[model samples]
Target: MSVRSSAGRVRCPVCARPQAQCLCSLIPRLWPPTQLLVIQHPDEASHALNTARLLVPGLVNAHLLITESLQEHPAWMRRLQDPRWRNELLFPGEQAQVLLPAAVDLRPRRLVLLDGTWRKARKLVYLNPVLQSMAQVCLPAGLVSRYRLRKVPQAGALSTIEAGAEALSVLHPGFDKHALLAPFEALIEGQIRAMGLARYQQNYGAASDPAVE
Candidate 1:
């Protein structure tokens, strides 16, 4: 069911965003070579700026499962166990390998991403032991997340979609990162409009603004 805005406008059923800022048209179904599986925390589903929900649908090979623990889903566990594709965890750590072609040798890889705040994402890893067993990969240092609506708690932090896009860009230069981020940028712009330029500038403008002394 689609939600209604305070102004009584029917929101887009697919994206759940307001009619004015609906991402239905901007979203693309690019079944990239690398498979993407996003495990989301239930808490994020209610967030208006949730990017995982928007990202999964755009990719034909991507799947989004909302759960704190992967052990609860036997079928998904079996899929992860499948030897057809090497499953790797996308997270940062001291032992994490940098995501690169020479490093990540698997031809057809399955990248598992966890979507949540720093604290909650850590808890997800703790709850799922299989995630711990998999080879962990991290994007190169010095990359920044485009998610300006929320404060970044750590260096090189990226939203679920941004992480996926970055990984894809590294794996396949042909992958259209811009196509993937179109809806994401639109969503942010729409929110800024809703808040008005003055209010957005007062709260987050400085952080998002690139010009500085």
Candidate 2:
């Protein structure tokens, strides 16, 4: 499968999206108090529609680490053991509790988000014992995911960018969650324009109207 355009379309080095669809200019300069860490599966690093890239430029506190296994990475291990930050995995499962502002302690937190398709995310969790041991939390109930470019695995499942924004909103109460998604929505619209309305609608089953935004 082609991860990017092979037909010589110049690409943006920052966002890695095609130059025509690049949202680099839309990335806002905002740093939230809580640290954001994204552990992305290797396969997703080069995917055309990966949302993890969007997080890097949008949030100054965000960092993306790509790996299939975190069993022996020095830096990863160091961060996991860091005493200054409490790490919690942003995942939903039987053990995951609903993430609320009051549930978080006053101490600084490093939110670890797994970035990949549902199957890949589950594989990453299973492969990394450290991740499995971290405290797990889920986003608030009824928060609909607007990541229309791809099919969600289940109801309430959010894209990496959306999840990060929601977590930041909870962690930093005054932050605007909707602003974080502006670039994401723009990216989706750009893709729809690139693909043409008919094809876009056929693929995603949604009307392609730039004005709808």
Candidate 3:
């Protein structure tokens, strides 16, 4: 077996996206009221299609951390204990409350998102007791995911970028959710273009697929 090296591929030094699909220019410099913290599984860090990387550049206060276990990182644990930032986990579990305006506490905070496949994300939460103790929340119902490049496990499941954008929208009502999604949509469109319409539709489903758009 052989592995391909990205060194040969022309990529943007900053966003790390391939030159053709680089979103650095499209990313906004606005800082949202709330901080975005994406805890990505090590496996997802180098995935060509991962959307978590697209998030940081769009929001000034956002950050992405790659680690398999939160318990292994003392800094993250300290951040969780920090009084200045209210830490909340964005996950869809039985204990997770709806992230609606009335249901959530919109205080100065760091919204933690697990960036990985469904199974991997669950493993992360299960392994970290600190994450279990934190308040967990889910996006409001009736919202569809626009991450068309990959197949989602469920209908309402959103990509990391989409989830972060929605969290920002809920936390900061003044922010424009559409603007946040613009670059995300571009990333999907770029993939679709690279794969060609037919192949993209075959792998990700048709444009009419409810999960798409």
Give the number of the best model, judged by lDDT: 1
Error in Å for residue 144 of model 2: 1.5
Clashing pairs in 3: none
Q: Give lDDT tens digits, candidate 1, residues 140-188.
A: 8899887867778988889888998889898787899889988998887
Instruction: By TM-score, rank the candidates, best first.
Output: 1, 2, 3
Candidate 3 lDDT over residue span 1-213, tens digit each: 223336777766556677766787777777877788888999897788777877877888888888887768898799887776678899999999887653465457778999999999999898898888888999988778777776778988899888988888887788877777777788877776767777777776686543334
Residue 196, candidate 2: Cα error in Å is: 2.6
> How much does each candidate deviate from the true structure in C-alpha RMSD?
3.1, 3.2, 4.0
| Residue pair clashes in candidate 2 | none
TM-score of each: 0.89, 0.89, 0.87
Give candidate 2's total backbone clashes: 0
